[model samples]
Target: MRWTVHGERTILDTPWVRLRSLDVEQPDGARVAYDVVRLRDLAVATAVDDQQRVLMMWRHRFVTDTWAWELPMGLVEDGESPEAAGARELEEETGYRPEVMRELIYAEPAAGITDSRHFVFRAEGARRVGEPSERNESDRLEWIPLADLPGMIARREIVSSATLVGVMALLLDLRA
Candidate 1:
């Protein structure tokens, strides 16, 4: 069952997101308008140290009003490659620069609602150079044992989808 596209219009466009309205014929042959969100691609880094611990940050998200532990991640800026963006975001968010970064996984967190792709990378052997770029984003940074992931997720401590997926990928890699 394919919807026939009648027309489409850009409702709003911005650096972060673009909103579009599309007119299409439904399965019942009725015409309707649907809204779509176009977002920039994001990069997430799962930085693991020599001790085989995953680097994580504890921060408060204003929109969700919850404090959660998450991996370092950010949007891939224009003209930047996913690998570069992952390294940049890792350094910026955690103040640790990875010596080796490899793409681990790529996923669409919400394919139904948004057009945003998240690239997850495995960063091995990172070194803390200095303090985080700022203190507002994260109040504490720590290396958590991978074995503790299940408990954390069950407790709702790790809520970010990118972070969860990245950690699961890391765990799978370890098992393999």
Candidate 2:
């Protein structure tokens, strides 16, 4: 069963987010206006080192009023590939350049109401290039041992859905 989308009306449009009301008919024959959030595709870089540590930042999200660890990530600009965007964010936010990068996973954190896409990439190892060009990104940067992920997650220290999904996929890859 699939829902029928009759039409959509833009409620608010912005460079970062778009709000829209969709006229949809459910499989059960009920029609209603459903609100959806549209966001730019996000590119996330999970850089790891030879020491088996993953690069991360401790940052505060004002919207949630919470602090957590997150990977270097940003919106994918128009005409840029997800990989390229991930690389740019990694360098800008962390001052590290990946020697090699590859796709790890893709996730839609809130697909039920948002068309946002998350492109997660794994950077095998990185080398420090210079100071981060994008300031105020985070409070501290660290190469966190992968072994600490479970504990960090258990303590609610890593809360971003993108980071959670990416790390879980990485952990699964390790088992494979």
Candidate 3:
């Protein structure tokens, strides 16, 4: 069963996010207004080297006041493909350029509240170039061993949704 959207009014509009009030009739015959946050699509990458180490960043999210390890990611700009954006973000955030990028998985984190799509890619290898193009994005960048992923996750050190999904998918793909 699907809900029928009768109308939608913008509550807030910005380059990064758009908030809307949607008037809809549910399949259960209830009509209501729902607030939704719409976000631009994101491109995320998991870059792994030949030594079985995955490139990661240790960062803090002020909103949650938490520090965790995450993959390189950014919003997909207009006119830029997800793969291109992923490659750009990987380099800009970590100074590592992907040698091979393949789609790992896509995730919608909060479908009920936000229409945010994350395009996750896996890079079989990467090479470090110059310094990172952008600073203050992370406290440290490290090439973590693949065998340590489960421990990191268990320790709550790898907490970003996109990173978790991408890494798990890549692991599964590797097994296949």
lDDT of 3 at 70: 96
How do the residues 115-141 of candidate 1 rate in per-residue lDDT, one tens digit apiece? Answer: 899999998778888778856679789
1 against 2, candidate with superior lDDT: 2
Candidate 3 pairs with clashing backbones: none
Local accuracy by lDDT, each model: 0.89, 0.93, 0.91
Each candidate: RMSD: 1.7, 1.0, 1.0
* Ten contiguous residues minimizing lDDT sum, candidate 2: 167-176
* Backbone clash numbers for all candidates listed: 0, 0, 0
RMSD of 1: 1.7
lDDT of 2 by residue, 50-161 (tens): 8888999999999999999999999999999999999999999999999877999999999999999999999876899998999989859999999999999999999999
Model 2: CA > 4 A from native: none
- Considering summed lDDT, which 10 consecutive residues are worst modelled in model 3? 122-131
